[model samples]
Target chain A: EAGVAQSPRYKIIEKRQSVAFWCNPISGHATLYWYQQILGQGPKLLIQFQNNGVVDDSQLPKDRFSAERLKGVDSTLKIQPAKLEDSAVYLCASSLGGTTVRETQYFGPGTRLLVL
Target chain B: DQQVKQNSPSLSVQEGRISILNCDYTNSMFDYFLWYKKYPAEGPTFLISISSIKDKNEDGRFTVFLNKSAKHLSLHIVPSQPGDSAVYFCAASDITSNTGKLIFGQGTTLQVKP
Candidate 1:
């Protein structure tokens, strides 16, 4: 079975510029997530989508970051007016959406973004 | 507050030896724990996991041990190989949330020498 897929494995932008990352979840998977990982830290969840609906986005920077899962299959995460500190790897993951919360999430290759 | 932490930033071991990675959590609500291995320039892949109710769970050469009373967990890779070298992260989740949200640690870099 194919795993989660992401586009533009690497990206570079200037400060204050905008950048976007795309993610396509595994087939039949209904839950998607976006996370940010700094150079030495583990991935921090930015947002979560459960079938075209936002489940959690408390950590996302509302003033500069936004994400959407329109059809519940693929999702996009955008950051406007990027800052130098925003340079990090953005990871996308998915899991079967069901009442069981212990399901393992499959991850993509991730998009490494750098804001100069 | 940092709920999960991997105190050791890195560890080195000889091939055919044992590699042990440790993690600690401050949240008592976390009932499920997982370990993920990540290579450079790649995303993390699920390794082994242990629920709060169980103290140990083993998969092939990897084993996860959970100590709920101490809020600590560990990953053991026996007969470690060079292929096992990578950054290892431990994640925890409170299944009650129903959203499957995971809180990850800072991660430990493991180097296995041939």
Candidate 2:
């Protein structure tokens, strides 16, 4: 079976510029998530989507970051006025069902973003 | 507050020796824990998991042990192989919250020498 898919494996942008990343989750998966991984650090959850609805986004920076899932399959995460601190790898993951903590999540190759 | 922590930044072991990675969590509410393996330029992959009710869970040559009272966990890989060299992350979840959210540790890089 195919795993989660993400676009633009790498990206570079100047500070204050805007950037967007895309993600396509595994087939039939009911939950999708976006995470940020700074160098030398483990991934941190940014937002979660169950179908077309938002499940959790408490860590998302509302002033600079936003996300949406359309048709409950594809998702996009955007950051405006990117800062140097925002440089990190963006990862997308999916699970069959997110109702339980036991559900294992599969991840994509991830998009590495750098802000100059 | 950093709830989950992997204190060891790195570890090295012989190919035929055992590799043990340690993790500690401050939240007692976390009832489920997991380990993930990651290679350069790739996202983390699920390795093994253990529930609070079980002290140990093993798969193949990998084993996970949870110490609820101590709020600590460890992953053991026996007869480690070169291919096992990667960053290992420990994650925990509070199932009672019903959020399905996972808190991850900083990760430890393990290297197996031939």
> Tens digits of per-residue lDDT for model 2 on A37-103?
9998888999999999998999999899999998999999999989999999999999987446578
DockQ of each: 0.87, 0.81
Off by over 4 Å in 1: none
Predicted structure 1: lDDT: 0.94
Q: Write the per-residue lDDT of candidate 1 for residues A78-116, one digit (tens) a residue.
A: 999899999999999999988787899989999999999
Writing each residue's lDDT as its tens digit, candidate 1 over B45-82 gives 99988888899999999999999999999999998999
Docking class of 1: high
lDDT of every predicted structure (CA atoms): 0.94, 0.94
**Which 10 consecutive positions of candidate 1 chain A have the poorest summed lDDT?**
A97-106
Ten-residue stretch with the least lDDT total in model 2 chain B: B94-103
